[model samples]
Target: GPDLLTFGEALVSLRSAGPLTAGGALTPHLAGAEANVAIGLARLGHRAAFAGRVSDDELGTFLLRQLRAEGVDVTHVVRDPGRPAGLMFLERRTADLTRVLYQRAGSAGSALGVDDLRPALAAGARVLHLTGITPALSAGAREAAGWAAETAARAGTLVCLDVNHRSKLWSRDAARAVLTPLAGHASVVVASDDELDLVGAPGADEETLVTGLLARGVSTVLVKRGGEGARAYTADGRRDAAALPVTAVDTVGAGDAFTAGYLSGHLDGLDLAGRLRRAVTLGAFAVAGHGDWETLPRRDELSLLDSRQPGDTL
Candidate 1:
């Protein structure tokens, strides 16, 4: 019922029974940062679409199937028969920990351009969710991410920007230059403490950093601090709450889950504190599952967390 479209990479993931995916991992659920958020939103009963580049090869098709299975609109997902879908290796370090290694080179996700931006932000879509990783993929992909922000603004969709800074992909200066401007156009933003540091506020306190974002035009900022809980600042107010306790599991997709929760609350018109709690619970659930996209809880399950024991209701 909402106008939400999230754009980013979707790669086929392999879970190796052995140490790694140097041809030893078992095939598991396929997912990525962008895919996880899109699926999460769809599962929350919102009509979501993913707009990004994917290879036309088998892996690309597999990615599409997963999206469709999760009820995500795949029309905006373009296939590049000339390229191949990227692949990733996720290794379980322990029952509660995992290590990931990337092998995404020459993947079709790098072929994005400005044209893909407008179509995905088509009429009826109210938000365009983006991450910092897409811009790090390639020049064209970066342009596409920028275009998505600009196009979404032109279309009147709120921009939801997540500062997922992967230092392995780009330098701090490069990240600040690209992400800060894109963030300037967003009304809502999510970032971890470390990411905000890379965005040129390497030593600013949480309060000042988030306030800086509002000064730059963003109305809402959610700073996610693992274990310590998360804090949200809005034009109306700010709130700090504890993260839900759970047996810690894989940490790969926790941030994405937090994002999904906040966006769901945003769509539902929940207040600041209500949104923070939902975000925390979903993050706890993400690490509990083995695979990234596999562990994502649907709206029903998330609703259950809001029980009668003096809990916040959606």
Candidate 2:
């Protein structure tokens, strides 16, 4: 049985290989918010599992292979023979800004159904990680994400929600309609400062947003502020973690990395402050490297960050 289970869409990201243009060199990389978390957890010495749908195409096969290579169990993943896998294009103009274009309509991932969920597998996990991106895919995908969360909750598994709201996926209103109710089922809620609108608290300050989510049955809320740092609020009180200093290469998957680090620390019996520290540390690592899951640090690799010398040893 896996320690952590996550359900969502995994897509192939085609990024600009050379120059920025209409028809520039493109490079393919596997990416998905939830999948990235699963990979990160696995890298951090946790047993993680992924549940989602992908087509029986080359891209789909490649994604599955990558997940297994990262030690993420893919037994719950469905390979739909009819629909193709989802795909997205990422344009990296700079280290801080990235524009993503999605071509995932009617894709296998968007067709995820409740029947695709293996509740038996989820029941063995300690936490079920979810993201707002899957629900924004389609109605079926929305239902599937909700079902997985509810199922895990019923089995006494903690539900962790990441409101990774994407403007390209859906409007703020549409996102709120689905994400708010879904968040009520989660034990923990994670959202970026700009994405607090998903919980129907648009433009509200960090304190207000945290209070709102707590009142909505969420026991804990994490507000992620890029570069500035992150804050966590619980019934007991609140804690903060400063962002680790690093020269950022790409910031696209930093949140997922943070979530993975947080979950890994939680499962390892770390205190709230320790979990938050691990989260910020991994978030910094994500930005310092290129690619999504590829940049995540393993448990042993974390000490390398403590090195101040140029030529450091393990």
Candidate 3:
């Protein structure tokens, strides 16, 4: 059994050099929020497992092989032959901006149901990680996400929820309705600074939102500020970490990488400040490269970034 368990949708990502309408070369990559974090944790030498459904196709086979190569436990992943695999297109709009388009309406990943979550697997793990995107997939997936959170909570496993809101999948009201209740079962809630309101109250200020979340039984609230940095709020106090000064190429998947680092530090029994430092460090590594999880550092290689100066060869 793994120490950390995460479940969600996994997609076959196609990267385009420019706009999708411009017609260019497409490069294939394995991508999913939960899978990315699982890979990141595995790279850091953690026992991480990913559970989801992938189509029984070549793309699904490639995804499973890639995750196995990264040392992530995929024993609970299902291969559904009825539905096709989901696909997401990443369009590099400019040097710094990237646009994502999803074609996953009725895919296999969206068909994740309550039975997909193995109670033993969920209960055995020390932490169960989930994201808001899973609930937005479909009614069945939403039920699965909620059931996982409730089960993990009852089993004394920490429920970590990342409010990864996807506007393309659903509306604000719908997202708030689902994510707000999901946060109730979460011990730790990670969200972008702007996304705080989704789990808290709409139009509430940062302080008010964070305070409300803490008051409602959330032990920790982590606010991710992309370039500015990240902040952690708790009953004790708040800790902040500035974003590392690194030239970012692709900003996608950086948040998932950060979540992985934070959870890794927690599993290692690090202090709040130490966890924040590791979180930002992993985030820097993600943005400093091209693909999502390709540039994530191993456990021993974590210090490599700190040892080298900008533009210096190791």
Of the candidates shown, which would achieve the greatest TM-score relative to the real structure? 3
Q: Would you estimate the TM-scores of all the predictions?
A: 0.91, 0.94, 0.97
Model 1: per-residue lDDT, tens digit, 163-276?
998777788788988898888888888889778755446677777777788898888888889988888888777878798766565777889989988888878898787778
Q: Is candidate 1 or 3 superior in lDDT?
A: 3
In model 2, residue pairs whose N, Cα or C atoms come closer than 3 Å (at least 3 residues apart or on different chains), thus clashing, are none
Candidate 3 segments whose C-alpha is farther than 4 A from its true place? 119-123
241-273: candidate 2 lDDT, tens digit per residue = 899877777888999999998998899999999
lDDT (10s digit) by residue, model 3, range 1-314? 68899999888999998878989899999999999999999999899999999999998898899999999998899999999889999988776678999999999999999988875354479889999999999999999999999988988898999999899999888999899989999999999988999997899999999898898889999999998889999999888899988888888899999999999999999999999999999999999999999999998888777756778986
Local distance difference test values of all predictions, in order:
0.79, 0.87, 0.91
* Model 1 residue 195 lDDT score: 80
TM-score of 2: 0.94
| Cα RMSD of predicted structure 2 | 1.8
Mark the regions of model 2 whose C-alpha exceeds 4 Å error after superposition: 18-22, 94-97, 119-123, 307-314
**Candidate 2 or 3, higher TM-score?**
3
